[model samples]
Target: MDFDDTPDEAAWRAEVRSFLEQHRGEHADARAWQATLYDAGYVGVAWPVPAGGRGGTPMQQAIVDQEMARLGLPALINLIGIGMCGPTVIVHGSDDQKQRYLKRLLRAEDLWCQLFSEPEAGSDLAGLRTRAVRDADGGWRVSGQKVWTTLAHLADYGILLTRTDPDVPKHRGLTMFVVDMMAPGVTVRPLRQMNGAAHFNEVFFDDVLIPDAERLGEVGEGWRVALTTLMSERLSLGGGGTAIGPKPETVARHVAEHIGALPADRQVLARQQLGRGYVAALGARYTGYRQLSKLSRGELPGPEASAGKLSGTRSARDLADLAVRVLGDDARVAASRDGDSTWQNAQAGLPGIAIAGGSDQVLRNIIGERVLGLPAEPRADKDVPFKESVA
Candidate 1:
């Protein structure tokens, strides 16, 4: 496929650039900036017009992402809402649900988090034990815990996956819901990372009540609904990583600036490592472009999304390691002392990227089974009821 933009795409990119140039500084915060983008029809460029989006092409939305990152603009504060939750809701939500959440989500009026992962059910998400029982009032009462929940502390709402029927098979017993983060019996506690950031949290629910209207999909059909969110998540985490991480040129420049201070022998290895990282970054970028091409065809992200996330996160972690290696002992110094901690934070935080969305091993299995058409792995629990499965 031709990588070059068509004439219309060029015009769209130009329009996006002009808008950013004119108003990049007008917004005081990320929420305000997101609101401005919503008003300008740039927030959800590929969503349906009826869902408060511009109903544009995926390529157009990619252009907006590219231009925003190119200009070093603050990202939309409600990334979870816009990237994963909104898209999933658009595909599976009721009309009223769309009308109630889509516009406010785009405008950053409500922040969202994913309440899918649990301490034991992360990689094997189908094994989640979080329980939600039907109440007498035709609603549900949820009681469970979620770990590694990004933005839970700051979010107003979350897309939650829970076990609604324990008698059925693990994958068949699940349900999805839109939960209010500030509701009674909900608690969020931050989990501080090695980078000193509290972006991840552990959330607990104690009989939290959710109306029937908040159900995302039919009972026992949550696995299907969740796949929609998961696909979008992999795209955002993997495809977007191509544009989000530190570039090879930046690493090369940093090494050049600091190599002389290192041992003469280590300097040669640093140069060699930088070359390898550059090649790997190129591979990840092209892999990401494949996802974009598929999306432009109006297709849902396929297993290739797994490949992108796997390679992209690995590349990011490796590059961060290289950055720290170049910095040597100085890497341990506090950011306040050095007046810069970009590499330090990256080194500390990037390892988790591999684990987030999905682990490297899980992603590889997806690529192997779906892309290569390999034989499936044996799973003893594939047909077992949730309560009968080994805990």
Candidate 2:
């Protein structure tokens, strides 16, 4: 695959860089400043034009992501919405649904979260117990609890998966819906992580009513629709490393600079770890391009993408471990110590990824089955109903 960008893509990249420089000049408060990015049309670069995107190619999207990271822009908080939900809606939603949610989501006018994992099911997601029963008016009343829902407190809408038929086999009986976060019976309660941040939550749906029109696909076709969303979600999650664009190199430089400031005796193996981390971060940046190149050609890497996630996740964990070691007592600060620890939140949160979006073990299983073409693991409950499956 050609690594060089076409002249047109280069021009587009220049334009995006110019716009980001003018309106959002790498300021503090990176998270809140991301709205300016959406306003500038630089966000969601490769999403469809109909969905308020530039309709760029996957390669162009990768270019935008790299540039955004280069600028140290606050990472967009509407990841679930733009990266997962928006794509799913474009692919599966009725035209009206697309028109209603896509642009708003891209513009960050509405934030969204995923309501897939339930109290009973995570890796074995097909066994989720959230129930959605049809109502007299043809709407559905959803009742159950979803755990590990990221950014649920700030979400305006969520993509919900519920078990519509328990008698059917696990994967054959579910449905997907777009639920309003403020609906009467919906409740979001923050679940704090070790990092002292409550970014994810437990979402309760107690008779939450959703119009049939909001359903993503036909009943029992939820898993199919969900696969599209999940695939996109996994792809998005794995695309870039936890360090993101230029942040790793910056951290490496910072580590070196700080080491020079300390007494000669204090600089130790910690500096070497930082140097290695910087190289890994650069490797991740290039790996993102490789994935984008394949995706640009309409190819899905599937298990290969898991390698990116594993690399990114491992680097994050390592960097965090290194930061605490390198920064010494400085890591105790509530805020990042010289941006080297900005990823502390992510570092603290890495375990969630290992377990959340397809756990490490689960991704290994995918690699074994899909990439290696190995014999599948034996499972007696493969065909069982959702309710009948052992927890």
Candidate 3:
């Protein structure tokens, strides 16, 4: 692919840069800044115009992301809505759905959380037990629980997955819904991690009522809907790192500063590990470019995109581990010393990436089967009825 930008692309980049320079000279509240981005026609530039977007090319979207990173702007506040939920709604939502949701979503006017993972079903999302029975009035009454919810406490709405029919096979009995978070019977309790932050939460739905109009797709089609969300999710989560404290360069600087005082063999090993990490990080950057290239074409990021996720996450984990080793004593009390211990907090959260989008083993399985044409894993349960399999 030609690396050079065409004249129009260059002009678009220039426009984004100019807009940033004039509007935000320093860090700002995420909600306010994103609203400004929406007004300035910078957010969701590639989404369809009918969905309250600029109808810009995916290359334009890439330019916006690049400009935000180059300007050192804080990460967008409503990443889940813009990156995952918005795209799914654009593809599958009714006109009213699009009209009612997209504009507010882009502006962060309505924060969204995803309710897919349950205590029982996480990686195997089809095995979710959250039931949604049809009420007498033809609406749905949802009763179940979801865990590891990132922002349920702060959300105004949620894209929910439910087991609409338990008698059928697991994958074929699910349904998706757009639920109002403030409605009665919705409960969100904070989950404190070892790092002492409660960013994640557990949400319980006890007879939560979902309007008939809020169903995302036809019954027994939740998996298809969830796939759309998951496609966007892989791109979003895979693209962003754990965002923990001290970056690779910061730890490297610490290592270099203390290198002269270490024993000779120890110094050699430290330098070697550092070199390996630098190269791995460099490779991950280009792999990320490949992912962006796929996304820019408006294609759902394919299995190969997992390579980017794998490389980026592993590199992050390596850096986090290296930081702990480089700052052995400081690491011990880092979390206790400050709430903003970027490195320590990062180390604690980095392991979650292994299982976040997909575990390393899971990604490897996908790459082997989908990318390499290898033998697929045996699945005796694939076609069994949900009740039978559970029993």
Candidate 4:
């Protein structure tokens, strides 16, 4: 793989940086800044033009991301929708579905959440029990609960995965749908995380009606559709820079300005932590570049996706811990009119990065199975029909 960018890539990077400099938010409103990026066609660079994408290659897309992070631009909040769900819909959706969803999704007109994980099903997504039964009028009646849904409270729509034919095997009996969050029988209750934000929620669908047109794929093809979503999810979640931590350079500047104001001598530890974070951040950037190169060449870096996630989670958590330690007692407080307050927010928010989008442990398993070519996780339920196995 090419480590350094070609001259054309350098030009693209400059263009993206210029856009970010002109339009990005003023050190806050990170989500809003992302919306601006989307509006500028810098966010969905790799998406096809037909899907409201810029029709750029994955490498070009990664260049945009790298440039944005290098400029310390805050990430967009609708990343899960645009990066994961939008791509999946583009691939699995009918033409009408794409026409209806992709532009709104890319433009953040309708934020979306994934309704897949349940109390019992996390990594083993096929074991999900959300039910979507065919109604007499050929619509779907969905009923179930989904937990750990990020931004569900803010979502205008959701991509739901539910069991349609339990009599079939777990992977075969499922179906995927695009459900309006405002539709009857849908409820969202935000879940408060250890971080100071309520970013995720528990979403319940009680007899919600979804037309067949909203269904993403053929009957009994939910798992296949879900694979597309998960693939995009794994790719997007793992391959980004900046994450939840204050960029190392940002931390260092803060340290210089506030060293005397902090408790005890924090300079050494803060410097060390910042150094480690920079290394990890740089490593993730290179790894993401590698993956993007592979994707541009029509290869899916499946197993290596886990490696990026593992590194990202570790880097985010470590940076948070170190920043918190460096700040000592101040980390406990919410904020004040000071630079340290920013670090506190970063500290409180960093652990969440570890837990969200397939936890660190899950990443390890993916790496083990796909990259190492280890013995696959044994499954007695693979061949059984969904209904029979559940019974």
Tell me, by lDDT, which candidate is best: 1
Tens digits of lDDT, candidate 4, 1-391: 5666678777888888887787655537655555567777877888999888888888787777677777766566678898778877988899998998888787677788888899888878899999998999999999999998988999898899999998878998999999999999999999886545788789989999999999998989999999888878877777744343555556556566555655555666677777887788678756766786676566767555667777866776676666566555655563654444655666676776666677787777777887788888789999899778778
For candidate 2, the lDDT comes to 0.77
The residue ranges of model 2 lying beyond 4 angstroms of the native Cα positions read 25-40, 240-246, 260-268, 275-279, 295-302, 333-346
Candidate order by decreasing lDDT: 1, 3, 4, 2
- Candidate 1: residue 295 Cα off by (Å): 4.0
Model 1 misplacement above 4 A: 296-302, 334-338
State the displacement of the C-alpha of residue 101, model 4, in Å, after optimal TM-score superposition: 1.6
Per-residue accuracy of model 2 over 59-154 as CA lDDT, tens digit each: 666667767777766667787888788888988899999888887787677899989987778888988889999999999999999999999999
**1 against 3, candidate with superior TM-score:** 1
What 10-residue stretch in candidate 3 is worst by lDDT?
Answer: 238-247
Model 4: weakest 10-residue lDDT segment is 240-249
The residue-by-residue lDDT of candidate 1 on 282-342, one tens digit each, is 7777877776776666676566567777877777777778888887777667355545889
Q: Where is the poorest 10-residue window by lDDT in model 2?
A: 240-249
| Residues 1-391, model 3: lDDT tens digits | 2355678888998999999988765446778889999999999998889999999876788788778776667778888888888888888787899999999999999989888888889877899999999999999999999998877888898899999888889999999999999999999998987667777789999999898899998999999999999877776665522222234666688778756666788778878888887677766666666656665555655664577777777877887777666655555666566534666777778777677666688788888999999999898878999988889
Assess candidate 4 and give its lDDT: 0.78
lDDT of all predictions? 0.86, 0.77, 0.80, 0.78
What shift in Å separates residue 389 of candidate 1 from its native position after superposition? 0.5
